[model samples]
Target chain A: MQANRSRFLTIMLTLGLAFFYVPMILLVIYSFNYSKIVPVWGGWSLRWYRELFESAEVWSAVTLSLQIAFVNATFATMLGLLAGLAMVRFGRFRGRTLFGGMIVAPLVMPEVITGLSLLVFFISLNQLTGWPAERGFTTITIAHITFSMAYVAVTIQARLTGMGEDLEEAAADLGARPLKVLTAITIPRLTPALISGWLLAFTLSLDDLVIASFVTGPGSNTLPILIFSRIRTGLRPDINALATIVILVISICVAIAAILMFRQQRAEMRDQKMAEGADE
Target chain B: MTASNSVSATPWSDTDGQKPLVELRGVTKKFGDVTAVDNIDLDIYAGELFCLLGGSGCGKSTLLRMLAGFESLNSGSIKIDGVDMSDVPAYDRPTNMMFQSYALFPHMSVAKNIAFGLQQDRVPKNDIADRVQDILKLVELQDYGKRKPSQLSGGQRQRVALARALVKQPKLLLLDEPLAALDKKLRKHTQFELANIQEKVGVTFVVVTHDQEEAMTLSSRMAVMDAGRLQQIGTPTEVYEFPESRFVADFIGSANIFEGRVTEDGADHVRVQTDVCDVFIDHGQSVKEGGKIWVALRPEKIHITKSDTPVTGENQVSGVVDDIGYLGETSIYKILLPNDQIIDVTAPNQTRPMNRQHLITWEDKVNISWEPSSAMLLTS
Candidate 1:
């Protein structure tokens, strides 16, 4: 019975993972189909990829998405680092727990609610200040930063809480001023957390679609927004081609990042091993 | 007796003997409702090794932190080299601290860790490299300069921390349980090395530790503290031989204490009528008529014998041997007196097999004796 149960569990997990990836795999396969129809085996060709590259509209949307993601990731990471540092180093005060809860509220709240609220807020600001008269790249970037910073803050905060405070104290004892201590000791020690926060913010910004659509104006549509619009008109080979390209890009970036992190972990373990050997 | 009707004797020349490098005048620190350091007045002589010895939560470390400028004084003043250090921040103070954890930077190499302070002060690049090399050599870590702290053993990491703290050559070095993290064998070896370094550099060193033997072996002068208050401060010989109070006597080493009443008070000594033994104590404390007092005698001061020994110039008592603990160099015997008091006596393990039956047994009749001056009278 135990053997049977183990076999069943393995089968169930494999089925779950396959179920999650089947649609994307189908979409990627159909992007190279020569016939303009569904579920029909046709000779494979690169015509859809060629058409995708030639379309100025598609390239413009891709450029806008990249620009928005870069800006939002930078701003979100900076704000998240400051917030994490404040929560970790400073002692709790009145309403401190409530403030922390509010900062992370965007991560758990419904995305539709967040998008609608941001749309309303931007409209009110434009009415009052006569600035940013319409939602465009600026509004979309702001909305992405507002939502994505929550993930960055939590990831960075966990790392900061675990890192020791002794290094900073030692730096000060060695005659470094407060600013110097932060630059020489604190920042260098926090490099791992900073990189983690940046990646989380970047991925969240790239994945946004509903919020981007709600805040974007004409001629400022991001990749995800353009994809959603295309899907409504009906699935085309161009949209499938775009999806395949995005999947390939994300996979490559994530693979490189994971390899770098694994190498770092191995280096750390090797150093600890050497130290233990020396001790004996 | 209060000698000569004076609180403290004043020296003739301040610089010849030199006033203490750091002085505290009624310094006190409070953390919200709890008082960490009580009002303390102390003088730390230049180039001398001073230790603050106490148990955990006894405020020895807190006092050291205050000296290092990590904690602010709640009241009174602190001076380093005759300069007041109250307003100075930790970064500006000319003092360095070696933390209990030996807080070396994990990411930086050993050389960079030692060079951090110099680089922060904007020293020239060539000078920084030279100083780092010199300090690395001073710590016997010249070959491990490129290795990070995680790539070093505990003892090596401790040396790196020491080199990092000393590279700038601060006026005073504060060590918080510097050798507490090492194993027994390493701690013994490192204590001597640390003392040699302090002497060679000619800098004042203040070490804080709870180990009494460590303090006694390493310090020129030491202070005993309990419950955030300084109990007594003196040379190791004075604190061990003539403790001013029962607390100091018990904390520093093992002592047999007996409650007694004064029967005679002479010009230079006193006689106490103890319940267990009518001992004569020659301490210089004033005791009035019919006043209660206490006497503390070291175990090594008492001699044990199997038979009653007649003595002319010392106090003696006869008892039964209750137990025996044979250490390698010395043997400890517990003798139970007629009054139901167990007295400890330590005898040297000199020669072997002189007397077969005298090799101390349980419930064996024995005699213990000590000189009159060996006992200390504690009034408080």
Candidate 2:
């Protein structure tokens, strides 16, 4: 009976994993096809990859998306760190409850609603003050920051609260002034949270499509927007090649992250052993 | 006791014309609707280890924090070395505190933690290193300077916390529950080591702890607090031997306290009659005849003797032994009096019973008596 149950569970696990990966695997295989049409399998070739790299449209889209993600991560991290510190360390400030609630609103709000409201806001501001006159990189990046910072804020807030006031109090007790304590103790301690929050915001902005589509205008075709518009008409082999390249880049990043995390674990284990084994 | 090193009561007892090291005048603090610490005035002499002891929520910690400038007083003022400290923030205060959690920076090495305070003062890097090395030697953690706090054991972390706070050489060092985080055996050993270090440093130490035994052993003089109020302040000997009130008597250690009436007041001794027995005290306390009073008796102070002669007199009572607890070091006897009162008496177990037999069996009539000075007379 146990053997039968174990066999059933193994089958179910394999099926579930295949269900998630089969479509992506098929797309990757099609990306190497020499045929122009996506579904038809021809002899394998790298023709579509060469075409993707040679296209000016794809190059512009890649640069646009990179720029937006970079700026969004920087601004989101700074603003979110300040917001998080304020929520945790300010004790009681004016509108604290309201700010705390509003800071996490973007995380739960529907993306369509957020994108629509931001688009309406930009249009109104342009009409009122003739500012942000053209909706392109600026509008899309702003909308991206508005939502990504909420993610960063939640991450930072949890870290700040978990670390508690003990470190700060210890610093002050050791005669470090308030500003000195912030620089010498608090910020250094918050480094892990800050780095993770920035990376999360960057990923979130880069992966967004619906919001970018809603806010994007003339000459502002981010990678997602370009691929989405092209796929709306028809599926092409070059788009498959582009997607396969994106998956490759992501896999490389994931592998590097795992290796770095493994090295860190090893270092910590050594420290632990040294601490336990030292006679001194 | 080792820190005091004085045949006299306390080393600083002769501060006839000298100013106190730290003075708290009417210091008060409130948290929202609860008064955490009521108005309290205190004078702590220099080079003495003083303790503030109480149960939880007694505001002993709040008072220590006020001295460290972490908590601002709702009213009143504090002076350290004759300088008003109301305007000084925590970082600029002349006092440094060793937190209860030990609060060593997990990210910094042990040496950096001890050197942090000196670095804040902009001390030269070489001097800071030397001082850190010197303090590490003092705490007996000389070889552990390069290790992180996580790499060290609990006792080592405690020493690092102590070294960090003491390396500053502040006028006053505040410690909050210093030995609370240790195991029972380690706590006892660390208590003496802590006192020895205080003596070596010669800095005024104010420790806040809820453990009565810790306060008694580690303090030359200590204060007990209850309900945000000061209950008593005296040497540990005075507090234990003669507590002024019922609360102090019960809080300090186990005591059999009962209400009684004064039957006679004489120059040499006073007699108090209670429901259980009559108590003859050594000193003449001020009380009118037939006035209501209270008396406390420590279990170890009374002697339990198996007898059937029916003894009757002041400072003596005859009762049936109801229950006997055979603790390894000492046995506690619960005696039942004729008035159905229960009294406790503890006796040392110096001799073992022969052939699996007990010395005092159950339901045996026994006579218990105490010396004149053993019964503490309490009026309040």
Candidate 3:
């Protein structure tokens, strides 16, 4: 009975993984299909790939998405870094808890609400200041930064909480002033979280579609928005080709990061062994 | 500043020996209804390993934080090297603090963490590197300078914290539970190293800890605190041999206390009548007639013998041996008196009995006694 239960659980886990991956596998297989239709596999060919590269709209949208992601990630990370430090370090002021809640509120709230509110905020600002009359790249980037900043702040806040107050105190004791301690000790110690936060915010901005749709003007559509519009017109082989390439790129980046982290761990173990040997 | 090698308590040099490194005059700190530090007055000289020893919530940490300029003083003034530091912020304070957590920067290399203070002070890049290298060598962490704090063990991280604090050469150094995180063996070694470092640097070292042994081992003069009030402050020997109150005697070391009434008072020796026994206490302080007082005797001072020899001490009690606890170096025997008082006497394990017939039985009558000078009088 135990063996049978074990076999049944193995089958369930395999089916679960396959159920999740079957579509992506089909998409990969179909990206090379000679025919444009999906599901019905034709002889292997790179016709969609060729088409995808040749499409000016797709390339332009990809570039725009990258640009927006870069700007959004940079701004979001900066804002999150400051806010996270303030929340963790100078936590004595009244309304601090409330303000911290507001900073992270976007992480749980619906993206549609965030997009609509940001659009309204931008419109009011434009009316009041007579500036940024057009909402396109700037508005989309701003909206992405606003929501993505919450993720960055949360990640950084965890790191800051664990970082403790000693490093900063130690730095100050060594004759570093307040600003120097922040830059030299606190910021350096926070680098890993900062990098992870930037990458997360960048990915979030790149994946944004609803917010882009609400805030983006003409000629400023992101890749996700472009893909959604294309899918609506009717599923295209080119869309599958783009999806396959994106999936591959993201997986490769993740794999490389994992390998590097593993190697770092092994090296640290080796160094520890050597130190022990020296001590002995 | 160089220290004078003379043994006249002038460990750290000050102009004309008039200025203390840190002085707290009627310093008090309160949080709402909580009095964390209550009217503390202290004068810590330079190069003295001054320890603020107390239990948790006894305001030792609060007093240390106030010295570090992290907490505001509710009343009284704090002066560092003769400069009033009432409004001085932590960032502006001339003193450096070693946190209880050791708080090394997790992301930066050991060298970078050590150099953080220099960089903040806007020191030249080359000078910062030189100083970092110097401090790394001082802590014997020169080879581990490239390692992150997470990669280092607890001891190494402690050294990094020490190097970081000492590199600045501040007017005073504050340590909060400096060796509390270490194991017993490492703590012992670190205690001597800490004392050596303080002597070499000639900076005033103020350590706050709950470990009585650590305070007794490392401090030149230590203060015992209870309920946010300073209980007693003196050398370890003075505090141990001549405790002013029951709290100080009980907190610093184990003592066998007996409540008694004064039956005889003399110039140097006083006889007291206890419930179970009579005790003669020799103290310098005067006592009133028929005054109630408590007499304290250390466990080692109480000797136990099966035979009643011609004893010369003024106090003696005969009791049955209740239990025997064999420690590594000594054997502790609990003797139960007729009045149901159990007195513990620790004897060095110098002889081992070969036969069971010679073994001390559970109900063996033993004489427990101590000299008059060995007793301490504690009055409420």
Candidate 4:
């Protein structure tokens, strides 16, 4: 009976993984296809890749997306850190419930509604102040920060709650003022959470489509927006080539992060073993 | 006996004229509707290792936090080194606390952790290094200076915490359950080490702990707190031998209490009548005749012998041994009197039994007697 159960589990696991990865694997294989049509499997070649590299529009969109993701990740992480600290560390405030609701509203709100409301808010602000006269890079970046910061804040909040106030109190008792304790103890201890929050924000901003589509104006086409618009017409081999490169880059980044985390865990285990040995 | 006469007779330190290093006047703290620390007044002498002993939620830790400037007083003032500390922040206060969790900075090396306070104070680079090295040697962790807190054992982490708080050389150092995390054997060893360090540094140490034995062993003087109120403050011997109330008598160690009404309150001795028998107390108390009182006798102070042995004493009772617990060095006996009241008596097993038979076996009739000088009269 145990062997039968194990066999069934193995089959299910394989089927589940195949369901998730097979399409991506197929897309990657087709990116190398030399045929003009997607389904026609010609000999393997880099024709689509060369065409993708030569396309100035794709390059411009990639650059714009990178810029927006960079700015959004930085600002979102900073804002998220403040929000997380306020939620976890600051005992209580008068408007704490409202502040918490607003911070987390973006997480649960429909992307279309959030995008539309933000678009309306920005148009009214422009009408009143004559500022941000046109919606483009700045508007998209701002919109991305609003949504991406929620993910970062949640991640940081989990880490901060687990990291109790004892260390900070100890720091203060050791004569460091509040701000000094933040810099000297709290921030350094929060390095792992901050790094992960930044990475998540960057990925979310890069992957955004609906919000960017609502806020973005002419001359500030993000990679997702460009690919989304082109797909409306029809799928192209160049777009497939672009997607394959993005998949490869993301896989490499994820692999690097996993390796780093594994190394840290191993180091901690070694330290614990050494501590136990010393205790004995 | 007169209350003032008994107060002077207790064996605790009397800070009659010496200037106290830390003083709290009417210090009170409340959380919502619950009082965490009620109106409390305390004076701790300079260079004294004082302990605030209590059970969980007894407000000992809250009192320590107030002393460390971590918690603001609700309606009182704390003075340290003759300076009113109401407005002083924890960072600016001349005090440091070794947290119950140790709270050693995980990211920093032992040397860096020790040097942190000095850096915060803007001490010179060379002095910080020298002080850190000195503290490392003091804690006997000289070679482990470069190791992070995670790389150290529980005891080592505790020492690192001690070194970090002590390296600052603050006027007063507060330790909250400092040795609570260690195992039994390590706790015993660290207790003395901590006392010795406090003596060596000459810093006034205020420790908060729930362990009665820890408080008795570590502090020269300790304040017992219960229900957010000060129960008694005295030396270990004073608190143990003459507890001010029934709570102190029961909490400090095992005590067999006889609830009764005072029959006589003389200048030298007091007598109380209970269900089992009449209890004779050694000292006089301010309690009136016919008033409710309790006579507390320490377990070890009672002498147990076979029932047939003809023993005459001022405070004597005969009962059957209900239970016998043979601890390694001593044995505890629970004796049940004819009145159905059970009393605990502990006796040292000076000689080991050759056979399975103990000197006092279970269900054996025995006579337990204690001297009048050993009995305490308590009226609350």
Kindly report the fnat of each predicted structure, to 2 decimals: 0.79, 0.58, 0.48, 0.85
**TM-score (2 decimals) of chain A in model 4:** 0.96
Model 3: how far residue A169 lies from native, Å: 1.7
TM-score of chain B, per candidate?
0.91, 0.94, 0.92, 0.94
Summarize candidate 2's per-residue lDDT along B7-69 as a digit string, tens digits. Answer: 334645555545788888998999999999999988987887999999999999999989988
How many backbone clashes does every candidate have? 1, 0, 3, 2
lDDT score at residue A99, model 1, on the 0-100 scale: 71
Best by lDDT: 2
Which one wins by DockQ: 1 or 2?
A: 1
lDDT per residue for candidate 2 within A1-280, as digits (tens), equals 9999999999999999999999999999999999988888889999999999999999999999999999999999999988998999888989999999999999999999999999899999999999898998999989999999998889999998999887799899889998898888888899889988988998898899999988989989999999998999899999999999999998998999899899989988887787667533
What's the candidate order when arranged by decreasing lDDT? 2, 4, 1, 3
**Candidate 4 lDDT by residue in tens digits, B1-380:** 66566443432244354577888899999999999999999888877789999999999999999988878889988999999999999889999999999998899998988998899999999999999999999999988998988999999999999999999899999999999999999999999999999889988899999999999999988999998899999888899998989999999997888789988889988888887678887777788899988888899998898876534445887889999898989999999887898999999999878996788898898998888788887886
Candidate 1: which stretches are off by over 4 Å? Answer: A19-48, A90-102, A233-240, A276-280, B1-17, B306-348, B351-358, B361-365
lDDT tens per residue, model 3, A1-280: 9999999999999999999999889889888988867767779998999999999999999999999999999999999998998889885889998989999899888889988898888889989997678988888998898899989999999999987776666665555667777887788779899999999999999998988999988787799999999999887899999999999999999999999899989988986775455441
Chain A TM-scores of all predicted models: 0.93, 0.97, 0.97, 0.96
Worst 10 residues of 1 chain B by lDDT: B4-13
Candidates by TM-score, descending order: 4, 2, 3, 1
Residues B1-380 of candidate 3: C-alpha lDDT, one tens digit per residue: 23554434643323465567688899999999999999988888877889999999999998998888778899999999899999877777889889899877666788887776666667899998999898888777888888877667778888988988888788888999999998888889989988988888887789999999999999999999999998998889989998999999889988888898988887777888887677876755588769999988888888778954433336787888899887757888888887898988888877776663435557787888888788888895
Clash pairs for candidate 4: B1-B284, B1-B285
Candidate 3: list runs displaced more than 4 Å: B1-7, B10-17, B106-157, B308-314, B352-361
Better of 2 and 3 by DockQ: 2
Q: Give the winner by DockQ: 3 or 4.
A: 4
